[model samples]
Target: MEVRSAPSLLPILRSRQQGEVLTYLMCDPDRETSMSELAHRVGVPLSSVHREVERAEAAGIITSRRSGNTRFVRADTDSPYYDSLSDLLVKAFGPPHVLAEALEGVEGIEAAYVYGSWAARLHGVAGRRPVNDIDVLVLGEPDRAELYEALGGVEGRLGRPVNVVIRDAGWLRDGSGSFHATVTERPVVAIEIKKQLGRDPVPQSS
Candidate 1:
């Protein structure tokens, strides 16, 4: 799995840091986070997070309240742009973020990628309809019970169910038949999981 920043989210929010800030606040609307916490989660400077949070406040996209010396911020549901931006952020960053967080440190996972409608939308494919469910393709045999438990957090965050398909490593490595072909042809967002160690999840053409 490649460790990379989400450049796809930049155009939607005009800044990756801002998008991340929004993700933390809006993904779980009830939860309030401080600028310092956002900075840590977003892997950016505290000053940058402060600037984005202030900008969001000015735009009425989010609201901040003080608790003693600490201030916590959350999305302003009253703002008309709140729902739309939340949906966009969920689509752009939700699955990848969820997958990485949930599946990290879980054993027997070689690789993971998001496919189907959600992935199509992520890549900006023309005519891709609204995504109602997330489709995840997981390589290596993981315990079904544990995997489902992990995915529960993702479902809650995205407000949709996650449909995960587990496959054997050899099945993909051998380039077996139509399923492999379809996965290779379509738009796929590779998930950077901490436990993955194997061949490329995506197949190369002959």
Candidate 2:
């Protein structure tokens, strides 16, 4: 696929899919993933992801191997571009992924989403001003202190401020406020929080 001419959050990349694919592989170099899982995580179609992975592999940006009938890919750590490119990806396209990782096992959280300008840009909405910070909306009854503490370092990691808004699940379902209305009306990207297994679980009581 040809590079998009439209302005993108990561201006240097060919397409959002390209950025997502590269970020997923490069930012987590130690992990290897199947193409289908890569597609699911990046929210891009399998065909598009396959093409991007093929191009990246051809350029030595990533490497792939066959595991039975499955094709798995990972970042080529030896590539001269690995270090710099991974850093760039982490800064530009790493919010949802990074936030998800950070909030993975935090208790009392039902769902999380990134909304506002960052989401607008991710959803391909052209904007007049550059996105300066991330706005996250959490839906659940998580401990306020714990939630904030969990997200404390996100700003440093992303090199920008992260403003999070907490709302209970009841409010999301029944509230009629303008804030709720606006958020429901706008583009929001869901953060996928995977459960941590085979490790000591976070204590329910401190």
Best by TM-score: 2
lDDT of 2 at 57: 97
Clashes of each: 0, 0
Query: Residues 86-195, candidate 1, lDDT per residue (tens digit)?
Result: 88787666777768879995788888888877666545454424567888888887888898889876787676789988887765557667877777777887777856
Whole-model lDDT for model 1 versus the true structure?
0.74
| Cα RMSD for predicted model 1 | 6.7
In terms of lDDT, the best-performing candidate is 2
- The clash tally of candidate 2 reads 0
List candidate 1 segments past 4 Å from native: 1-88, 197-206
lDDT of 1 at 123: 56
TM-score of 2: 0.87
Record all residue pairs in model 1 with backbone atoms less than 3 Å apart, i.e. clashing: none
